[model samples]
Target chain A: MAKTKARVKVPKSIKKGEVFQVKTLISHKMETGQRKNKKTGKKISRMIINKLVCQYNGKEVFASDWHPAISANPYMAFYVKADASGSLDFTWTDDEGKSVKKSAKITVAG
Target chain B: MIHKTLETRQVGRRELMAMFGAGVVAAMGVGMTPRDAMADAKSVTDAMMKVVGDNKPATGKIKLDLPQIAENGNTVPIAVEVDSPMSDADHVKALHLWADKNPRPEVASFRFSPASGKAKVSTRVRLSKTQNIVAVAEMSDGKFYMAKSEIKVTIGGCGG
Candidate 1:
């Protein structure tokens, strides 16, 4: 069975209107088409996680378009302002029409 | 085998068909060669032009952070941060990263909205050789910002 895990890191709680860092990592094998199969002398088709979008409180915050050059087990870090206590949802889509979703909740204290 | 003299030549339909087949095959061979040659023959500027068009970004308010020297090129840390208020009227729309010496110049692109709070992102990329990594940021106001840094790689990232 293939293991798919989405790791998200954020502060347990933050003051309202404070800026915070968000880190995410997903387990994936970003395959570039440059490699040739050893057993069969044919080029491997490129397949990678092409897009990742982050939404905070049901509003889009950050997104990315990735290429095959990104390292395997893709990792991305960005900053987001903590306004009110809400949830951050992430969706990662690959070239093969597969997508994985993950979300985290944060508490804002003023 | 058909032998003929110019003065008294004999024409055969089968011979004309054979000649036409060879011409078609030769043309196809020429067409197939360029595809393989083009795979690794694109320049950095050409790739960048496809994204930014004729607008060359100015240098400021954008920071591209990467190592000056990387022992292994397989994985090099890179971070791009832009100074923006992240307000409704002003924000970063997209960020494009590229390696000047890689087989393909464009590495990745990141998009941000005002809700992001800050225009900052970090990731890892592969380097083919010692070259400059360029970052171009497109803002909401239709202005562009640019930043670049060079890295020396001991071991190339792209496998030979």
Candidate 2:
């Protein structure tokens, strides 16, 4: 397993009240616990990101509950309306209470 | 004389077909492999019913976009949007996605707030086979809207 990396993209030109897209990508094996280890003949336990949430400024804007059906190296895109200058926080958490957090800044002047 | 005897011992096509059919039927039977069990329409509806409950989602506000045919099932791109004003008074509460043919019915669910200016999202999902992808949108008022579309997968994502 390699080091987990989370990437986020925000449009360079975000104006006040304008609807913009926020893209996110993360690296994970997303093991579904269905396959058996070839040599050991033991079922590989499931390990996947269980949820992702986004917070704008101090408020929660978007969140996702992910199941194993989500493909490996998960990618998600969503829209956000920035009414004022604030920071965006993204967190991806797995079943065992482990989580990855990333943040971005946006300047929307009134 | 031995070659003639060997030909007579060879299995006939009719018998071979019967054996293949039985294998398929056995695979389709319940409890064969619960982790990779194929889902049917009734099972899909029942699972959706568990979420939407008595509201009975209507089919108008959701736009589920999926490819008519996916060459690769490992990473089929999908997008969904619901018709909503996204105002604090009336906004989309959540969006749920389901791949009916997968062993598990629930794919993912996204919660939205007014700050999410648009009730739109896009993501990638794994499809076990050719099946319907269902999307349901829940409005702030508790009304649910449903939309379903099918994707034909040439190769299933799940490999045994």
Candidate 3:
């Protein structure tokens, strides 16, 4: 069985309405099913990170769909505006029905 | 006398035909080499094109920043930035990345909302070889833009 893991990094504190960077990386094999198994000599079935969703304070902020061509250990960094202090949850699902979730707290001061 | 006996026991026409047919089958199986892998790749591309319709026009506003030469095709740094203010009125809807020569052309698509505050993203992607990387940007007003760049890979990556 394949598994998915996510690592999220963001600033602990940010200013309201100010843009801050959020970086995320997911570990996946992302098999395209086009290759062959060296030992079995059979086609390896496709496995990929199918869906990713990000929520800030229970509201969806960003989402993406990944394909097999997405490199292994996919890393994504983007900007997010800090509107209020809350928890940002990130979830990703793979082709094998495996899902990984991680959350980070955002605190806005001044 | 031994030679005459062997001649008498020689294979019949039916056995000869069966042997020839078996040999032909074996040869045909071996002849179907993997050299024509490119044909399979073409069909994959055609499917991708159908998914990514021609509704977008190539625009210079989108910039795909990648190294001119990548030492490793397995993990190449890629950045996509669009010249747009991420506002509710005119924010970037989505940005799609594609590798022309990759086994799968649709590499990644990032969906954004105004709350994202920026139409920029950075990530790492796998490239099979030296090929063109294309980025398409969709705006909130149903308009599309794109940009592309060619990257040369010194070593073949993506494990074939």
Specify the highest-DockQ model's number: 2
The candidate scoring highest on lDDT is 2
Give per-residue CA lDDT, model 3, range B64-95, as digits (tens). Answer: 88999999987899888888888889998777
Cα TM-score per model: 0.81, 0.82, 0.79
Better of 2 and 3 by DockQ: 2
Give the Cα-based TM-score of candidate 1 against the true structure: 0.81
Colliding pairs, model 2: none
Give the C-alpha miss distance for residue B148 in model 1, angstroms: 1.6
Classify candidate 3 by CAPRI docking class: acceptable
Q: Give interface RMSD (Å), model 1.
A: 4.8
lDDT value, candidate 1, whole model = 0.78
Which candidate model has the greater lDDT, 2 or 3? Answer: 2
True contacts kept of each: 0.72, 0.84, 0.76
lDDT by residue for model 3 (A2-22), tens:
355678999988999999999
Clash pairs (backbone) in predicted model 1: none
User: How well is each residue in B1-160 modelled by candidate 2, as lDDT tens digits?
Assistant: 6786577447444554554455446544533321122222234665555456567799899998889999888889999999999999999988888888896666888989999999999999989899999888878887889999999999888655
